[model samples]
Target: MATLNGSPVGLADMQALALTNYGHFTTMVVEDGAVRGLALHLDRLVGDCRTVFGAELDPEWVRECVRREVSGCAGRRTVRVTVFCPGLDLTAPDLEARPCVLVTTRPTGGVAGPLRVQRRTYHRDAPTVKHVALYGQIRLRRAARLAGFDDVLFAGADGLVSEGCTWNIGFVDAAGSVVWPEADVLPGVTMRLLRSAHGRHVTAPVTDGLLRSMRAAFATNTAIGVQSVAAVDDVVFRTDDPVVTALREAYAGVPLERL
Candidate 1:
């Protein structure tokens, strides 16, 4: 279920990640021999490697590593690829790093529905990169869940809705256009895939005030696909909204690529 550079991952190989926690990763869902948005996922890994490690990563090698981990898997599975330098010294930081690729897989769970989230005013460090530092997001998620919410929705200091703990959020305007919030959030692969399939959509600022005029909202990611947002704080949206249904259908219709 876990491999480091196509071989079994060892505890010693995880030292740097455990101590320094400096790395980037991507989570994807692979089914049988095919993956949705496989190219985008690899592109993200390659780009994040440059940003985080100041080094180039071979996307094809990463692809083969993923394929090695998920080959002959029955049904659906969640695969995570993490890139980090195991030999990095904190005192004498090396700019030129040879990062290691760690691929792990687990059985996929049933997609949850109608997320009820609490909005918090926070933003991630290097929000654009999918890095391994997740203490802040996990803390907020735990607090939200303890307070009777399913998850957390992060907003900027100006009260603009940005993203979820691990996914991107989109809104359906009164005119039935998909409104993606323009904020410092990770450009999600699922969001891009949905945008191409959903014809009428726009990128705009989604504020707490704007949510009142919105017709409905949904969360997008590889795991849940298009999941309706039932409530944000006290505001509630209908889970069966037609626009949300259309988005789900569009995402489902997207062709899966072979790995």
Candidate 2:
């Protein structure tokens, strides 16, 4: 049985509920009782909720709810907190702030190795907001896994690379230039920090060939701070490459709690 808005809700029940309710949702995964980038995630949730739902939420109430839910976790584990806008009938929308749904300590498989990525053509606006409507991403991930690639990288209709199915993408070129997708991709919290601290060292929309030299690349998400990419189709990136090593070390130097 799953949970929705603090009430017991089975997966089937939630799916049925969502079919009738048209709104947004945010999911944050916390590990070891520590939620990486919790503040940023909450801010995004609130901002997105207001944008999509057109009503402000009580941050203190939401924070208290999250605290209560997280306190239920056991050891070093993963917990998912979901804030959903259940009903949005413009004619008569529900303006209340519903309880956040908390699912305690669920297994997320083991830590994954560096990913092999395949490029596709798709782009999303407002990538930072976590929404419940993710069928397109879900389908792409399934197709990628079946093709033996760990994940899929999407390019905008204009041919600019956006991001991976679930994370932000960053690359390193032969000349050791660190390149990242422009703002068209999700502004990941980890990516934001790396950019702010090392802005002068990074490049955006780097030359096309740079993708080939890609001495190193990584994807960032809330669950994983910075994960190296093993390959892009047949092209391989060395984890020990000097540039890759330096970036990894820099990322490690940042307090994990800060992220």
Candidate 3:
């Protein structure tokens, strides 16, 4: 029961669909009609889908479907494709393979700058999946904008930092160690890759001093590969710090795969 570009898509239209109890979406950058990081994005999409849905999915099929769809696109463009569940019980076999909605090839707004951050208390269910249930994030963004900030950082009732409304939060210590909150935050794809390659440590309940020395801070999501953090609550850091530069380069060098 998925619709692509307002048209109903048949089962034969795709090789596979990743379903989850919570909604999910994906963003891709396309140039010359070719999608970048198709394999990596699909791998993550399938993996998250399986984890949230509590079932296994075919990786090869997902890859082929994305390939088929993107290959049909016509010209240089930046595309974002999103798939969401229609609030049905994901445990059902039929619903497991059918996404409620599918959107593709929309324009990316613009490159965001150093975000002005406002702290708030908000939590989400199934934080790992890229779901469409983003009311909290939407509200937080509007609040941030009205408050003259670019984004919002959520904290738990325990006075510990959770994450940004739309991105993972990272901090650097005076000792040059890159730190992030523990598993409470979404296991961001960029964070996972960076942690795997760099072996950085994840700390619990981020702090102010630690956030300040952030020598370099950035956020990673599907659309923006790695965006630098310029200022947080009027506190600014050197955007070109070696640690930040190295991470940006390392992330760029890792070849994207479809697995």
Candidate 4:
């Protein structure tokens, strides 16, 4: 289901996104009228709206739109809240910005994980914001899948690991500390939630050379809360890692906020 500002989305409303594709979005897992890190997701929407549209977004209104879309959903739902200017013009893009909220929901079941990912050197435009310009990520992910991998792990030209195609990458060191790569990737809500709940994480530079010193790796996102990484190219990590188990538990234990 899709809605624009609590109303049904129409073809005209989607034209701007298809033509310009200038917007920011946050995806979250909504279950039983509650969400983990709901505040973070809302904050991301508000901040990214200001960055992309030079306007303000009401988080409470966004929440209400989301609630309207998923009010009667059963089981689990994946909700995407996109902030965009539906009337945006490419030639005269500086017109007074009027950002609109587009909310969409889809039924979600089990999470796929223990991913075998391949490393690729690439970066995204406006890496700090979760924007809709995802050509680079989609291209690299497709290439990785065609090359016999489940997904792509992105790194910089300097060989420092950053993140996955659509998730944040985390490592478990020998000392069982959670290691987040210090890169210009998007600050994922799931990553932030895990860091707060686990309380034993550090931000550091992660490179291919440092993978040997790490014990295990995992992927964090709204869909798959914490998924083990079986391999990153030739380097394989233990899927039954205890640290990963603890992380999953910790993520599950985080209190859910009601909408």
Candidate 5:
């Protein structure tokens, strides 16, 4: 079942959200009532609400809402929290614009296999906030899927790779140092957690030539912690690389917090 601010979401609310897609959201998997980087998720919600709605959202209220939704869940569960304004960004004569929180849950399983991503030249508008408007990116990914690729990795007009449709991409050089693309991309929560565990990493222009030359590559997101990339448009990578293995282990070692 889906919920909104500790209450059930109905057809009217869903219909309203479809009109004005001006909101920020975050999604993460909660396992056995524990979450990784819980504080960071809360911070993202509060900060993004302030930026998008010109108002402050209480982190405690968010947690309480989430707790009420998933209070009795037994296994891995997915939670999506969104903050949006009512009345389609315009308040009525007696109404004022206030950000509303929406929470929903579903059962989640393990991560998928290594992804085979196709390169697409695309860029996100804001790149930082996890907003609601994403049909453009989703459309690109759908087209890539229809063509046999597992997902799409966005590139810039300058030929620099940024990130994936729903994840952050990373590469390892011959020396075994993790290299992230130095471009505008969403900084995923799992990406941040992995970076903290990975001692040190570098960022550079991830050009197509660089993608072809990298020793190994992987994708990171809340849905998939650190998944090896089998190929990036015919340029193959070693899924069993030692760097990828170590990262997977480090990510598994990250402690979880009660949700």
Candidate 6:
């Protein structure tokens, strides 16, 4: 089921979403009715709504709606909450922008195995807000898969690895520290939670060459907590490294919040 402005909506609401696909959104994987980093997800909607639509969305209201929508699920479910203006004029943007929340739920249990990625020089706009400007990313990911890879990793013009199409990239440095790239990337909820669990994290600019020299690496996201990366455009990584195993266990140790 899907909802629009806290009310039940169907295909018409989806059509409106596609027509005005100019909003910020966030997705969380709720397992047995609990989510990790629930506050972070809500805070993301609040901050992004203000930045995109010039108005703030009440976090409590959105939280309540999300909980109500996914209340009856049995197992793991993917919940996507979007904030948008229904009657926004794209031609003449104004300050009187009021946004509402739309929540959609679906069952999910897919496993993201060790990923093989292809690097590409692509820049994303407003990397903080998770908006619907994802056609380019989806296309690139599809092309990567067709070309015998798992997904695409975005790199800067300076060859600094930023992030994946939909996941935050992490690495295990020579000193066995979790190194988070200090690039303009969407600080993902999973990565944030991982950092909280593992405090020995270093924020540094990681170039492609530096990444190749790393001990092990993995990708993090809400859907798949931590998945190892086998290779990134021919530079193979230690998929079964002890550091990767430690990260997986550390991330799994994070507690989930109810709704």
Q: Residue pairs in steric clash, candidate 5?
A: none
Q: Per-residue error at 194 for model 1, in Å?
A: 0.6
What tens digits encode model 3's per-residue C-alpha lDDT throughout 94-159? 554444335455555666765557778787677767766777888987998799888888777765
Instruction: Give residue 255's error in model 3 in angstroms.
Output: 1.2
Q: Rate the local accuracy (lDDT) of all candidates.
A: 0.91, 0.64, 0.63, 0.91, 0.87, 0.86
Candidate 1, residue 128: lDDT:
94
Residue 15 in candidate 4 has what lDDT?
88
Model 4 regions lying over 4 Å from their true place: none
lDDT of 6 by residue, 157-256 (tens): 9989999999999999888888988899998999988888875889999987788789888999998888999889988888898887887898888888
- Indicate the TM-score of model 6: 0.95
- CA deviation > 4 Å runs, candidate 2: 1-17, 21-32, 89-105, 197-203, 249-253, 256-259
Tens digits of per-residue lDDT for model 2, 18-65: 664444544455555555456766676678667656667665565555
For candidate 5, the TM-score is 0.95
| Residue-wise C-alpha lDDT for candidate 5, range 112-204, written one tens digit per residue | 898999999898988998898899899999999999999999999999999999999999998899999999888889889988996569999
lDDT of 4: 0.91
- The numbered model that scores best in lDDT is 4
Residue 78 C-alpha lDDT in model 3 = 49
Q: For every model in order, what is the number of clashing pairs?
A: 0, 1, 7, 0, 0, 0
Off by over 4 Å in 3: 1-22, 30-40, 51-56, 72-103, 108-110, 198-204
Q: Tell me the lDDT of model 4 at 8.
A: 97
